[model samples]
Target: MSQPSQALQIRTSDGIVFDVCLEVAQQMGLTHSWLQSERGDLKCSDGPDDDANVMPLNRVRSDIFKLVLDWCQAVQTVDTPLEHKEMLQHQRSLFQRILTESNATDSTIFELIIAADYLNIDGLLQAGTQHVADVINGCDSVEAIRERFHIMYEGEIDE
Candidate 1:
């Protein structure tokens, strides 16, 4: 049996806490990766399983984060030629891994945007950005965007 890492913890502002394995915490969207992009061991702010933004951490079930990390890493490295069928296959494999490994409607494809950007995966970043663009472009007006993403535009039009 593998000894679990001591680094994983879930902490919340409400004083809830839970100790979790690194993998479980990561699957919970409580990965250090999700907390912030600080080049350190992935962590929750408070401690293992403290449930800051996440209540009853078991509710958010998705290992898409792991796949996102793998995809970002694969895209950043030049081990495979981008245009090759093999490369597409690799990407597809990563996608499928996310599908199979993750449960819930969350795909983590959106999360890839941040990971790709943070890792400097230009092609992947462009892909993610473009996908977001396509989604936004489908909307005919600002109201549509606001409704879809729950954003309040705070812009001043200077004349």
Candidate 2:
């Protein structure tokens, strides 16, 4: 009989630890690559007691990490391959749902974009950026866009 794969312990910047399944961890390109490069056995942690063996994601905040984990879980795939168009549409829909379900603010979406970039999650990055672009496109003017994203119109300050 085959042995069950152990969960990977991920410690975020805010000191929160999550016991993530190996499959979900694989969806995170950076984490998978890190694991492959290390080639060392990672101690599976059941709780947040020990930090020695936990993979540290210092750039990702706890709330964003939780959202990213939720996205990863939602998009976990089997061996089936999807075409580019279908995949893009599916990713867009999934991202929209994730944002709506989490009641994500514009600031939160922007944060997710940054986190996706850092994590090397291409799909999430693409979808997030696209969503931002779509929102911008929907706006009637620059001020509307700026207001929607809470961008202050900071004029040039005196040197």
Candidate 3:
């Protein structure tokens, strides 16, 4: 007999709930060291308790969680069937659009960084960090960085 599909329930800080495949959920959990026990069981050693089957991510916003989930899904599916090159390209285009749409502001990027770090999603963390670096790299001076990131400098500027 075919086995029933296994799923993992995720509950975000904003009370948003969603379901993902058990494999993907395990992947997400594996990124955080504390989530695994000595025997490699999915145990929350220093983290929040699991609510039945729902893993509560109380520090992550729902929208940001959604983006992180999308990133995870994209990374997981990057090696689809070789015959579906066109579909793969289309998926990549969608991923790029989503990244661009989310990267519209410094605050958004900051939120993404926070979410990625909290969720222990390494790919998103790297992407968010690189985006911040790219923004900083494009600036010519401290003033430009401040302006680009909308930072308020209360101290006197060095000549």
Candidate 4:
């Protein structure tokens, strides 16, 4: 049998600790960089009790970080590289399910985008920005797009 995956602890800005597998952690650019750094000897262990190993993420909130972790875990399940079209299809389906299940708002989605960008998770960033773009593209008019994002129009000021 294969060995159990090493647990990597991450602490969010909200002081929530999440124990993630090494595979998922390695997929995150910032975390992967840390894993490769000489000073990045995070106490990788099988158990989550070791608080000293926790990587603190100052910009990511627990709720949003949880979503990012979930996304990485789910995406990692597909071992093989998929075609471009297939990847887009899978991403769309996964994103739709996440949105429906979480009942996420536009603000939350935007926050997730920011968190993903901060973490340098390219796949997640693409998916989130694509989702926002798709939403705007589907809008019937400029007013609808503004309404969707809760943007209010102000009169133009003199240049």
Candidate 5:
């Protein structure tokens, strides 16, 4: 069953405001509910004043957010694809690089992958998942991936 939607006001880093549905806002990273929005608009974790370059992060560091948005724009427009703006193999190579360097790189790529998944960006998701799968299917065992990603294992008994 779908959760009941609520009203919410959100401000992006650019100072632009949006009257977002509560459910969509909940999709964001934070423990919040309708109660918080009762009095007035709530300042979110990704508020424009948020310091992405500093401690408190803004939705996928500012520069990375712009990069992801650029990728989205290029991928979404049919004209852009047909215009041969970027080759498919080139895009795959980029995703592959992001997937592999997930540890060394900033969290922006993962955030972008999550956003793409939520938005039903299948191409990006597949590419990202493949990159992740490659990591898992590499010399590292299943236990390695779990350890790297911090997943609690409950299925296996102690050896």
Candidate 6:
């Protein structure tokens, strides 16, 4: 008989751990070619094992990691109701509300982009980068960009 794939234990920098299916993780691009070599036996070449395959994501914050995982789960499922324009609008509103409630700032979005890039999650990288662009689009000045991105310039300005 064939054995089923095992769940992977992903530990974030803040000590939060998530048990995710290998297939789902791979679908999110969380697993790469280098991971197999770096993690060695944790890749489970033979079959599923009882021990959790620990993958430490020391660079990503726990909350952001959870958010990405949630996004992955959400994308994996099909929602028929969301096809309607009204429903889609409502969902977008809800998403915005959640971000507002969570105090998700531009810095958070940038962090998500960095984490996504490091993890090779193309979907997240695209979404995050697009979000940043959308925020800065049509803005008039460098100050506006800096303010929106919560970045401070320490270096000397040219001209």
The pairs that clash in candidate 2 are none
* Ranking 1 against 4 by lDDT, winner: 4
Candidate 5 Cα misplacement greater than 4 A, ranges: 1-64, 73-88, 96-107, 154-159
Worst 10 residues of 4 by lDDT: 38-47
lDDT of 6 at 34: 34
Candidate 6 regions off by >4 Å? 1-5, 32-52, 79-101, 154-159
lDDT of 3: 0.67
Q: Flag regions of model 1 displaced more than 4 Å.
A: 1-65, 70-110, 154-159
What's model 3's TM-score? 0.71
Candidate 5 residue lDDT tens string, 1-159: 997555454434444444445544444433143334443444444764553212222343444434444455444444444333355565677666544554434245566676556544556666666666666787367678777666667775466
> Per-residue lDDT tens digits of candidate 2, residues 1-159?
999877888889998888888889888998898788764667644555666667889999999998999889888852578899989998999999999999999889999999999999999999999999999999999989877877776673344
Output the worst ten-in-a-row residue range by lDDT, candidate 2.
39-48
Question: Model 4 scores what on Cα lDDT?
Answer: 0.83
What's the residue-level lDDT of 94 in candidate 6? 42
Off by over 4 Å in 2: 44-49, 77-79, 155-159
In the range 1-159, model 1's lDDT, one tens digit per residue, is 987565444333334444454443443233545545433544345644344444332322224234444554444555645666666556555555544555423236565565555434454555556556766999999899877776766663344
TM-score, candidate 1, is 0.38
- Which 10-residue span in candidate 3 carries the lowest summed lDDT? 38-47
Clashes of 2: 0
Alpha-carbon TM-score of each model against the true structure: 0.38, 0.87, 0.71, 0.87, 0.42, 0.67
Instruction: Evaluate model 5: give its lDDT.
Output: 0.50
Leading candidate by lDDT: 2
User: Which digits, one per residue and each the tens of the lDDT, describe model 6 over residues 1-159?
Assistant: 889777777778997777876666775555654357556446443533433466778889988876677656655565554555664454344445435656887667678779878888765666666666667895789998887666778764545
